[model samples]
Target: MSHSVAEHEPAEVTESGNANGAGIDLKWLSDRVEYGLYQDCVHCGLCTASCPTYVMTGDENDSPRGRIYLMRAVVDGRASVTEKVRHHLGLCLDCRACETACPSGVQYGKLIEPFKVALEISADGDDRPPLLLRILLRHLFPYANRMKWALIPARIGMKTGLIPIARSLGLTKLLPKTLQRMEEMLPPSMPLLPPAPLPEKLEPVGKKRATVALFTGCVTDAMTPETNSATARILQHNGCEVHVVAGQACCGAVSYHSGDENGAKAFMRANLNAFDLSKYDAVIINAAGCGAMLKDYAHLMHHDPEAARAAAFTAKVKDITEFLVELGPVKPANRVEAKLTYHDACHLCHGQQIRNQPRQLLGMIEGLSIVPLEETEICCGAAGTYNLSQPEMSRRLGRRKAEYIDATGASVVAVANIGCQMQIRYYLDERGGSHEVVHPVELLDRAYGPLPGGTA
Candidate 1:
């Protein structure tokens, strides 16, 4: 791709992007992104194969190196933030697979993350996110209680079999596109029963090996409450005391990624205040996205007054699998009795470099045989809300994932992230597959014993 911006309009926007200072000043990118980070990319094309968007479109503009070049062009006054330029950047999954593929140790997430935020902030009215999506991201997703209450009607419909009937009759078409996608992603099973409320504290089942706090993520806890319950139990089963802070909130990824930089920082600060890092051996997060965001707190707040505290907090943040493996998991004795393939959540595998841990944890279970999945590390096109925003690319990638899952011939598909689980399950359902999509811990929990309400 040419580094020169597409010639449509002159680069008229100043540093403030507008007279009243609404959009980002392209010239000031050095203030937002460390100049060295962009220089780290050698444009080697090695990351192309790993980038989902480039793999799909074969457009260099969608690749990390190309995007880096685009950013450089815009920053150096050689290019304008044209609509076409924005579209290419918007299409990126931000899966950070390129970071895994890059030999130069470039922090791709750091570059793309803040750059996207700046790009969104500068977006003209025509290019801004739709109003409905803005409300959902700003209001609904960050609040656990609000999301739980909001899903009640859908839960009722699912319970009464009305949802399926509505879906079959095309009645769901009346809902907003985002809502329609949510409905489609909802598991086919009737009304999602709320999981048992985890106590603020749970003592270790055998002996107190460590004390840790659990991060009950906003949407993850509200949507799949059982995952959180199971996570707590598994921690307890392995001799760790778990604590849940009542005041804990979202990990701020939704807002941050959506270009609400202040909103993301606010959420991060709330979490920073909510957890006392000194008291716990680690702060455990079950969702991969949440874990990735929690782990980024120190970097996100590097220059803020809470820098010291945020650094302290981030050091203790660990994905449940990462924590368990480091603590030396107690071997699970019971049999799960299933053939399974694991799809690595991009953040868990690429962002956190946690490839072997979840698989190792699963390997400990009896009667569970793991199968290799083709392109298992590829994104399922559910990088948070990408499925709703970029439906075309999302659909293509989701279908691709479903095809791979089908080829596995496994009865179960184990995933670490809720987004991956929901996206894969929805696509698999579309392909008429009945495979079970579950968190790795859910399998471990089953091996330990039936969950709180007893398994189906």
Candidate 2:
């Protein structure tokens, strides 16, 4: 392993990484990370109640303040980066809820993200995630077409009931542990077909209000195609000329969060060159994770030579709901009569500070009642790939979220991210609850009228 805590004794470490010149690349821990970030935490417990992991475990080390302290200690050479420390940090959802909860305005993402990247750089053969899952995460997920092709077999198995039959026969247990966890998280009855891709162009129904490029990132595109189609239709209904730009790849969130920074950068660069900012008023994204990642392009590429372009690209990025609200969305004339509650995707509400825009849009549908969900801001254990990596905690939080949604007495639940929708639906199904978890845009699309290829 590149980083072994046992080899280094306690010593005064400086902002300049690896002052003692150990075998580790301590520069990973220091470079691009401001030393002052650790100072922003006032040790206040205000964020704990809001932290999903802390609320679930009641472990101080699982809390943001505690994790910050751990990373700082390891960097300062006052403490070692033991396996326990790694576990504590790995458990983080990176939902950025702490940023919203912190009064002193701590940039927790800046600190935690770098530290996780450093761990990836330092980890050895034995320290990495499962080999099979790692390959899928690295080689498959960031590529949309590859993911769609890869899921074809699984979709067939699902349609034929072979997947459930295998589970019943205990055949799936012979598979890799990571795959087993993923299967457990699948919706009770997985869909047979992916959503149809959006056309390159969709003209406004009445008069043009805005022109936007829709971002259909990898996982969301492969897993929830209908949501993407709905988002495009909704944008069109709102008097916006929508373009599904060519050459746009995954938003790099999967790679970045998986600790492949350079790979993430490549995806980001591809997206940067894909969209002509001059042609579009704003780059719209339905998935909250992809939206946050797209909007943070400036921060991610700050050190790159093309920083200006990244910032320019980021400046025009907006969540679909945010763009609609700012554009003064036209109210849908058709009624979508249903009682549902909105479960705030952590990235949309906390990461991007987009709390009200979704509900505001949902409120516009006639005869639609938007009920309040308890602990709506809490992460639903679908923090990117957390459910696969940390199955136990993920299940606990997923079940917790399902319970809260069940208590809402609503038949449908709206979520901004595909991950949340999948997790919630799985848990709801596991509990034998008949709840339809859907993207808010899907409902809006219904309100507007029939979809492009499907009936209302």
Candidate 3:
């Protein structure tokens, strides 16, 4: 349970002078991370076991408690941001498993998130993300239509069987490393064929029980459109009127987690203004990461003039599973009849503390049997863009997750997040396993298909 320090705590970075012996000037740390937040860690080591990075590396620096100590030492003017320190902190998946495991209630995300952002600011030259990824993160992923346009060729290749053939023939290796990773992580696009976007307003199937706005996320609509469509249908099936609002932007997680705090706040402000927060009972989000980010708007924009509005918006944002269960899901009569296991997308289980609602929704499927997954709550290495950024560690944890799924002997694997589903499918395919990855709402939609004689 004990982790060794990287170096005998160099004097921490300070604004007045080089507290760290190297004069590295990590003073940006104090601006982003609260000094009080670091004091919350009791160093119990309970979170070490839960951290995916620590579990994989067995290094103290990778564990949450260890990482906390490192950050605290730096903040307290006792440690320098050495390569060793950066390596340990960079390895974090930011899955927030430590927060879930901590008995002392450490807000691990708050400590690490802005810290990472500040680290990027301090180390802007050498440690910046690659240009291609920077382009994708900034220009491409945040815009739904832009993402759809970008994926057009890949979709065409998948449909034409060219993509698989290229992979089998080793042709894709010529591409850049990031593009290659994208090729490898690409899920089967067959399930991407989804019904059209829900109309501006969809009335409840029978009687309107609750009126809610749907946060159809950027990649959710472009990459996995079916889940978005399914969510609306499932909401309607549960007698909820759904509104797919215009001018709604990406939930800003892609930007926020990428160290562009201002960009993320811009996206957040757009979303806050997009929906009429008071009119809806809940703002439903299908993707776990987006839901988590949406729910954190208040915290993210706490000091801004829009803080009150962000707080109100955060109160209404709900993960689809959480809202459905709370709204009392309509039991589906049709039987899915598949042996399945659920992978707890880190954001859903830990970020939102929504472990049971998803399973409860799955349990409603008449004939589907939900088998237990070892380390279900552990991230599958698709923590936002982590797979693309930290390919090696990502694959290590991805394979570990794939191995656990294979051991379960389930034909289908259900996950709530878009990234987790993609990561799980990629690894399962790499190992030649035939397990299918799907969102929990898709299964519920299939179970609630057509409502007797009506078209879905």
Candidate 1, superposed: residue stretches over 4 Å from native = 1-23, 190-193, 450-456
Model 1 C-alpha lDDT per residue in residues 1-456, reported as the tens digit of each score: 323334312233232243342235654456667888878877776887888998898777777877877676666555677776788888989899999999999898988888788888887787988789889988998888888888888888898999999999999999999888889988666345565567898878776899999999987888888789889889988888899887888999999888888899899888888998778999999899889999998988888899999999999999999999999998877898999999999999999999999999999999998999999988999999888888889999999999998999998999999999999999999999999999998999998874334211
Against the true structure, candidate 2 reaches a TM-score of 0.92
The predictions' CA RMSDs to the true structure, in order, are: 4.0, 5.0, 2.9
Candidate 3 C-alpha lDDT tens digits along 353-449 = 9999999999989899889999999999989999888999999999999999999999999999889989999999989998889999999999998
lDDT winner, 2 or 3: 3
Off by over 4 Å in 3: 1-29, 190-195, 451-456
- TM for every model, in the order presented, reads 0.93, 0.92, 0.94
- Tell me how many residue pairs clash in candidate 1: 1
Candidate 1 to truth, TM: 0.93
Instruction: Say which candidate scores most in TM-score.
Output: 3
Worst-scoring 10-residue span by lDDT in model 1? 7-16
The lDDT per prediction is 0.85, 0.84, 0.85
* Model 2 per-residue lDDT tens digits across residues 109-193: 8888878878877777767888887898899988889978878878888889999899989999998888887776565554777
